[model samples]
Target: MEFIYTNPIGLTDLEVLEVGTQACTPTMKFGPGVRDMYILHYIHSGHGTYSAKGSSVSVVPGGLFLVVPDTVHSYWADPDEPWHYTWFGFVGTMAARLCKQAGFTGSPPVRNPDPSVPVDPLFSEVLSLREEPAKELLLTGLLYRILGTLTVPDDIPPLQPDVGLHVRRAVSFINARYADPIALADIAAHVGLDPKYVCRLFQQRLSMSPYRYLTDVRMRKACRLLRSQLPGIAEIARSVGYADPLLFSRMFKRTIGLSPSAYREKAKLENTPSGT
Candidate 1:
């Protein structure tokens, strides 16, 4: 087996614990060891088998396997075809949550990624980087993009009957209090429905999850606030139900394609008088 790169870094928020690529021989097998941080392997080619505590999964090209923090696991390459894969390890409070978006919390993180997408390249970039401009900021941004692009097969069942009414109720509640620290459970309770069912209704009726829709409302409000240029980004973030300024910035950039500061500047420029 060969590891293209192996290194660890230090960053508190969303740190890259390690990054590398490996080419395994027909007989290669990795151990029943565990890691301190979350790790995932994206199969670039060939196939392999991953075994966790009480579960195992088969993976192929474009597939991925996730190792949750401190989980004993083993993996081996297919004897006939072998396997070449790229992997990275990460750590942070948001690590598990972000990974869950890609369906990585399941038996197998079956990330059927688009070949043309930049997910693989992101891993390679992390592997290649010795240093970055504002390391924490840069790596965090990249991780967000990587997680954002992660797509799994939609195996969820279709929306249930009369779910639309609940969805509408949830929307109405969110519109009335988007700046509050509302949660899925709160919305479900408001609509007198289960949270998972509410999520399905949003998915089927609006093609977005309730949290996403809440974010949409918050971002729109942020735009209006940015145009007014009345409050600091931190204050604006708080006004929109976000407590962490950095997280607010990340979410703003992800949803709006521009940082809050940049968006505010742009808004200022547009709202300025012709002579001024």
Candidate 2:
């Protein structure tokens, strides 16, 4: 199947898309591509097959697939029976590093729909946000929660103080400059380590990368600004480090579920005192 990729600007540090299909007939191939990022695919229904790095697996409904960057992969639905799914694609130095911390190191895609896993609620919220644009703040909050759920492993040991110090410093840097077009290399340099090594260290400490964490910060800030009455949508966009108001609006709707202005008005009204 032919696929087109569009980078959605003004989405904090991440890019997300909502995908739905009636069927996957014949075979669809994902050509060789590398994402300097990570991909989270939540399978809501149907079935299909995915192949990555000499590993292949059949995907069923309710399955969630996590693919890390630079890994080769292809997927398709069975000729007779296609599949339906939604995917959120993201890239950031912090996010990449978080994947490593979660024990995801260049590993093959994980193919399990563990119902008992704690991520179901967060995933449900993300899907709900895609369908309802009036809930942007809620949606943005859920996205970060989802990332937190996915990357933080249950079995990892605590970090030593020195390592923890470096990790905390890295996180602080990411949070401080998430909206400033900072690069992963810059963050690594600030923390005094090689980029690749820093990524590993971040993954070890936080269970998610510094880039992903930074994206979360941006999204959170945007949501706050979008819901604030002090600034117009256009102004709010620029305040959050977005240059294009329209792009900011689209991403606001896509990720949060409402236009920035509408969200702001609603939030203001909700915050107003009764009979005031």
Best of the candidates, TM-score: 2
Runs in model 1 lying further than 4 Å from the true structure? 1-10, 113-118, 131-140, 151-276
TM-scores of all candidate predictions against the true structure:
0.48, 0.50
Candidate 2: tens digits of C-alpha lDDT, residues 1-276: 122233233443333422222345456556454443467776666777777788778888877666665567777776666676666555543455455544354436564676655665565555444445444444435546666666644554655676767776787676666667777899888989888888888777545677665655555567656554677777777766677889878877665557877777787786677799
Model 1, 1-276: lDDT tens digits are 223222223233355644667788899887787654577787878888898877777888877788875468889999998889877666543465567666675654455556656576776665445455455456556667777778455555644557645765677788778888999999999988888988887776655688887887688668768877899999999999999989999998887778999999997886677797
What do the candidate models score in CA lDDT, each in turn?
0.72, 0.61
User: Which 10 successive residues of model 1 have the least lDDT summed?
Assistant: 1-10
RMSD of each: 15.5, 11.4
- Cα-based lDDT at residue 249, candidate 2: 85
For model 2, the run of ten residues with the poorest summed lDDT: 1-10
lDDT for residue 251 in candidate 1, whole number 0-100: 94
